[model samples]
Target: MNVRTEIIAGITTFLTMAYILAVNPNIMGDIGMDKGAIFTTTAIISMFSTLIMALYARLPFALAPGMGLNAFFAYTVCTKMGYDWSFALTAVLIEGVAFIILTETNLRDAIVNAIPASIRNAIGPGIGLYIAFIGLKNGGVIASSSATFVTLGTITSGPGLLSIIGLVLTGTLLILNVRGALLLGILGTTLIGLPMGLTTFGGVAGLPPSIAPIAFKFDFTHVFTVDMLIVVLTFLFIDMFDTIGTLVGVSTKAGMLRNGQVPHLKRAFMADAVGTTIGSMMGSSAIATYVESASGVAQGGRSGLTAFTTAVCFAVALIFAPLFLSIPGSATCPVLVIVGLFMLSPIRDIDLDDYSESLPAFICLVLMPLTYSISDGILIGIISYVVLNLLGGKRRKLTPTMYVLVVLFILKYVFIG
Candidate 1:
């Protein structure tokens, strides 16, 4: 709660997830958008949106255009669905508008309340595995394989070995209860990479890239088609659950949750909705709450002041893009693995004595990482929960909203997916 500690925690959070600045542009570039514009837009939207989280909601969480959702936008929607970037951005805007409307009403809260407590409890651990998987993949400790889908990367490879070393070092620091363990882990790993030729330093400072190419580029025309509707729904679904999961997971881990629910839920939800709306207008993907904010929480950040400081740090990073971007994936990802552990603390709250509850929760926990989609994991978990309860003659326990969601999820996959 101390200001100095909060500021330091903010810096730690920002550095741990700064890779999004460079990686967002690269991924979107594959879809023919200008990389520099995407980079600038990513940073600007993240700064302003995260500022909203800090000032309005008084939470220590940060916001950014999400990683997996961006891939879906670039590769699946734009590339495979044949929608242009502008069209896809239009869908994002629609999704954001829908989110704002839902959050402002009883709908958002109802949806949150509809989720089984066991499944809600499982979200943290599920996201833990998801974050760890991302760290391993990005750090080159794991690689995709034709034979078995994924396999361990060669330990001798420069990035792979450095990541292993960083993981061990960071895990050790966490075991010793070191303050700023995540931040120190990243910096230490980056230093180790310098000698191994894994990290390259660019100039100390430079002007941020221009946002002109992508600014205000959304296309509303020709968006009334069925495909576009599906795209919008996909954006909406992912944005909804991802934000919900992160808020629940991080807040629970930070001891900010009360009565198994988030306080100020509407404000937090609006922050994410506003971010997505602006990101689409700014020509970026859907923005959501970042689970990496748990790193700040783990570092003793307890209030909005931490987020405000982190926003300031992100703004400062804009001028030193090269210096920040120079951090190798091998360096930052160790924080993900460590933060995953912090998030998984919620698992103790789950009721393992009930098979019906435990089975659905277990499915949710395992599917999140395996499917690589929080929304998908949630979808199946709900469906499974409903089915199990009904078959067990516990149908009276199901909420009306839960039944509605099960049908919606079923229709979503059948028609859109």
Candidate 2:
């Protein structure tokens, strides 16, 4: 790719994913954490992690606090489980250290290879649906209902209507093969919403908040409890699968996967592990490779230079927090919906003819969006795959690791969860 093209691709990736800077703070803020501190932590960790990916891994993927993982950290771990934020951060730190150890040994590769090809093929599309559901909820196109669990929102509402228009316009631009289509769609939608009285400019620039309130506030008390162990294991499993899934899905599209594996795989894993470990100390959730990076790869970003550009954009974002925060869900949600389309391309790799394979994959796909949890979808898929194969008298087809994972998942739900 030309240097100019790569730089543009980087900018495009940042634009498509920048909504996280605002969204994360709001989500975490619900539980009494300082929103300003979370915002600064989000930007700084994202910048550091992306820079690591660029310089060490030489991949185009961007790293940030993952969507579902953050929800679990805030709502489940802290609010529902009634644990403090420090304990949550400690869980993340432990998970990250375990990932580093796994990366240095054969266990990581073994776990990767142990997943059946059918389930492996399903995860990308599953995540696509999960994220798309997030977009729909975030944009207020869908909402919780007392009777039905979920119901359609008022389409005539300001944000809902704007999101619909944005999705259509963005989809059209992508179909026309427009350069920077995702970025353009985001800005255009925001502009349209300004006149509709649905969005306000929070000024152009401002200094970022200090990270002192949450920085290095980890608590080691009760870190060894059964509940904390369950939390840590959940983090470890989700981060591992999510990172591997993104590597496979994005690299496959970019033609960076050789012989069914990523080139420079060790460094890629290390980048994620190191990022997660550091991000915990910096008061963020588990950092992982973003599936949204596929947007950059789709734009002809072929090397680390693309990631470097994205990292720089994040640094610039710190100064212009208002501009980014000014973008409403109507604008940014379209990018998530569109990026989901890019990720779904790998569904063709699934073996659809075999019932054992196809059934498990189908359940995995449906559960992700329906349950709104990637880890839950993965756990069910693995258990279903093993049980289905065993009942089909295909016992020899199951890997030892697959059996172990099934047992562990069952135990987790039975006792810990």
Candidate 3:
């Protein structure tokens, strides 16, 4: 890549990925997370994810602790189900490691191959809905209620209006294929909010003047416990498949993958797995490839430089974490809706050859929004695949891993419930 072009690509990449660094920790904290650990972990994991993409994968991509999974870690695991942060974070770490192994073993490919195309189509929309829900929840636009909806912060407030404006502006930029659209949208909105008193401290995300936050006390010896391993194993698969889907979609956008081959797939995946492993040690949530950056990459990014720029930006943003907190959640909402739109682009190509594939794909597409859970949507889609396969009289079509997923699904229900 030309140096100038690389710089531009890197800048764009940074803008696209930076939001997660400032946002994920807060979202994760909503589930009983100790503030110190959440901030430290979120920052460090984002670094690892970016570095892996730049160095190992050498692809112009980025990764992080997925937004949806982190919320579940907080609300479902730590709060509702009563698991400790240790268990939840440990689970994230486990999932990451498992993702690594799965990518290495080619088993991940086997599972992806097993899914019917219809369900595959559904994954994008499912994920889009999941992401949109996350945005709303974080923005305080939606609150949980008994068989009903609740609103926390209303759009009528000044803060709410600024946020909504930011979202609209961000979404517009994305649609226009503007460079550094995310950064511009956020920065512009935050600046705009200052005059209106929507921003607390001039709308900049900055580190506290005192010492930056740190993580929980380390227990290095326990890193190898059976529980840790199991957690890592599960996340590994989840993150692995998730990234694959993203890579496939993004590669298609960039014309990087022609036919069945995506050049540098192995390298890209390796970087992500290594990033995940690095994340756990840093006291953060699991790290995995972020497909959303594809929007930036698709626009013209073409080298690891793009990802490296993103990582550097994340580190810079961490120094301003406190200011980052001041930006109203509503401002970020538009980006979420916009991203939801971008992610939805892949749904057009899903194969609807038979009900077996079509049914699961459609179900997966709808369930992400309805269940309000990405993992749940994926699990449901997987289970549906197996059932549809058997029902269609193609029992052999179910892979061994699919069977394992079925068994694990049952256990997850019995145990998690």
Candidate 4:
């Protein structure tokens, strides 16, 4: 591998995903986690985990706290479930351990195949809508309403106006095929927010914040609770599929797949699993392989050196905590909206003519944004898929795992909910 090409590819991948530095802290901070500590933890976890991926998996992929998973940790588990961040962290830890076991036993693929393709495909778009809704709300583009339960916010000025401008600029950059469109969009929007008093200026470089406040703060008291089971399962479900999808997709783009199988796939999964397990101890969300690594692969990254370079970049980013933490919600909101758009691309694969599949997929997609919960969307979608298929005389489409999941989901709604 060419060293310089690998370095450039690594940087390209890091730029595409670096927005997580700003976005994760914002999401977790809302639930009373220390943003400064989270910033440090995020960087540390990303750096080390990606380094592990490079050394062990020998792949040009990066790892970090995932987007939708973080949202679920903060909003669904902590905010709605009335659990604290520690409880969510414990759940993540458990999920990581379970992931490790599944990977070792070679059960990961079986579980992945067990989930219906329609439901699996619906998840990304559902989360996209949910994330976009959050962005709109954060930027003041959408507001809670008394009459209709939701309405448009004032867009002529303030955060809403800034978000609109950022959206246009970022959209333009994306249209032009900019490599770091998301990160550049965040920075550009933050600069625009300076005059509107939405962005605050902090020093660009400094010692990284201490992670002591949030690190190793997991709560195990509720580990046996039903809610904890649901939370852990949800974390595993999302992380498992997302990591697999990223590894396959990026490897395909890089021509690293050998006869439809990803070489070193087990090692890649282990890297993600180990990172997530340790990242919880560092007080971060579930870490996974990033789909954005496709950017680096597209840049001709063919070896672990590219991932190593990206890890080095994350390590360097630790010193810029203040700058990243100072980015206002409005500035990062546009990226979320754009990412939401990116996530929706999978919807094209859903066959709309078959109501047995399409109706459940539609339910899964719509309920995520409307209910503001990813787990609920997945659970209910599975339930609907199973029931509709059973009723429609399409019983062959149902898997044994689907039946078990549908039963558990029904029990959750009937008793716990």
Candidate 5:
């Protein structure tokens, strides 16, 4: 409708999602991975992902490297498994290409249909809580205080005070229907935290770290290694499903779904697959559609315009890596917490009356935070879906695909455990 409202929608979407760009790299850094290049490459892919979603797919949703998969890429691939980033990148590329083929062959649709209803229900709030958890972890608001609990800072540290101010300001702005409430919430918190020295903008003191922008030697000589192929392919599908779930949700909200299904699903799938391929080639992780665009949808955006705006913002942000690199973790935490709060609003519509729906959803939602794994949440939800269906005297619900998933889930849980 109004041009001003549209601009605010776009900007808010960017801010809510921007935390991923910074946090993903930091998480990688903890595992002794390449933080500098990872962040830089991530930002660049986000720019491309957004453009494709907006201009090509023509969806209001923005795409980027998803968080859950990034942790897997860094920790599982590089650290625990002892695989080089190059070989992992090769797996990412293979998965991306395979994803494209699946979409083209209409196999992606089959996969989506194969998921049980209850498991599908779990994805929404599961991702919301997951996003919030990552936000808290990155913002330093919820640090490990004890074995089983977290201690809050006393309104002093950057994250504590900013989160407090952000909650208030973002909440108030949302109430006021302020354009870009999410972005303003973050900016407002940053401003409030500034005088307190919590949101200090570290001036360019240290010489900016330098390395080749894209440094993986095209040596896919070990692309066929069994272990590397397995991990990479797994991550590829992980990213793909997460992205698809987010897109379906956002599209439904935008009323872009035809017959309750995405019409141009193939195009959207291709964009995600291609984005992931390019990301790894550039030495980043699996790029996928972001649920953070829900922040944009919440602000009244319903067109691809928001995605285009987010892409443009990311592209513009690349020139100022030195500046973005300096933002205090607390400053970003408030934005993330508020966005999580916004994302959680959809939980009200869920029909918890049906145990079939309620059981899997509860499992998936809680497992996300408790087990600290996205895939784990999905697995629990899937298992519960099958269990609930069978026990509820609906054994006919278990398709061949469901049986396969059940066997796979059981084997995975046993082996991984």
Candidate 6:
């Protein structure tokens, strides 16, 4: 591979995804994790995990703690479930170990195939809406109402006004096909927020914070509880499908798929599995392959060198902890809203003409944002899909695994959830 081109491609990919550096810390910090420590851990995990992808998988893909999964860890598991962040970390660790086993045994596909295509397709968009809602709330664009349950915030001032301005600016950049649109938007918003007293400017560069307080802080006391099982399974399901989707989509774009099959697929899965496992120990969420790697592939990245270059970039980013940590939720929240738009693209692929499929998919998509729980969306989606299809006389379309999932979900609601 041409070194210059590969380096450029790698930088391109990193810029497209580097917003995660600020956003993940903000999300996890909500649950009382040290933002500085999370920032360091995020960079470290991203650097090494992506290194694994480069050397072991020999692919031009990058890994980082994922977006929606982090939200679930902070909001659903910790805040909503009333569990500590350590409990969520332990669940992530278990999920990673389970993912490694599944990948090694080649049983990942079996589990993937068992889920209905409609429900599978719905998960991403469901999470998109959920994340977008969080962005709006965080940015003061949405507010809770005592009478109506929710209402519009004062969009003309404060964080709300700033977010609206950022949204338009960022949307314009996206329309112009700007590289690093999200990162640039965050910086621009932070700058704008300065006069409004919304963004605080800390010193730009500093030594990375110590991760000692959060690292290896997993709580395994609840490992045998049903709640832990649900959390772990949710983590596995989202990461597994999301990684596979990214690999397939990016590889297809890069012409790396032979006969509609991704070469070195197992190795790629292993890299993601290992990343998640290691990331938990570093006190982060489930690490997964980023679909933004498509930007690098589109830049003609074709070998492991591109990923290696990206890993090096993350390593360098550790020194900028102060700059990244200073970014306010108002600045990063707009990126979340935009990412939600990106994730919603898959909804176009769903066959809306079929009620049996579309109805459950619609339920899955809506429940995530409304219920504020990704796991609940998936669980209820599967249950409705099975019940509707079976009663609608389309029993042949139901898989044995789907049936099993429905029963388990029902028991979860009845017993634990």
Among these predicted structures, which one has the highest lDDT? 6
Per-residue accuracy of model 6 over 48-107 as CA lDDT, tens digit each: 999999999889999999989999999899988999999999999999999999999999
Kindly list the per-residue Cα lDDT of model 3 for residues 292-348, writing each as its tens digit: 677557657777888887777677666676666665556566566665676676577
Per-residue error for 23 in candidate 4, Å, reads 0.9
Mark the regions of model 5 whose C-alpha exceeds 4 Å error after superposition: 1-19, 67-91, 145-159, 191-200, 203-263, 291-309, 342-350
lDDT of 5 by residue, 94-201 (tens): 777777788789787676678765555456566657667766766666666676666654565556666666667777887897655655565566667668777656
lDDT of 3: 0.66
lDDT of 2 at 251: 92
Give TM-scores for every candidate, taking all chains together and pairing residue i with residue i.
0.78, 0.85, 0.82, 0.98, 0.78, 0.99
Q: What is the overall TM-score of model 5 with all chains considered together?
A: 0.78
Off-target runs (Cα >4 Å) in candidate 4 are none
Query: Candidate 4 at 378: error in angstroms?
Result: 0.4
Candidate 4 lDDT by residue in tens digits, 220-294: 999898889889988998898789878887787778989899989999999999999999999999998999999
Q: Across residues 1-417, which tens digit of lDDT does each residue of candidate 1 receive?
A: 599989988988887677677557656876899876777788888998999999999889999998657866876677666788888888888888888998888587655577888887786677677767877887888999999999999767688899899988888877886665666676688788888999887666898878888888878786776667657766776577679878887888788987988877778899999999988888989998988788888889988998998888878878866655566778866766775676687678888998889999999889877876655676788889999999999988799888887897788788877
Clashes of 6: 0
Best-matching candidate per TM-score? 6
Ranking by TM-score: 6, 4, 2, 3, 5, 1
Model 2 residue 108 distance off true place after TM-score fit, in angstroms: 1.2
For each candidate, what is the lDDT? 0.80, 0.82, 0.66, 0.91, 0.69, 0.93
Better of 1 and 3 by lDDT: 1
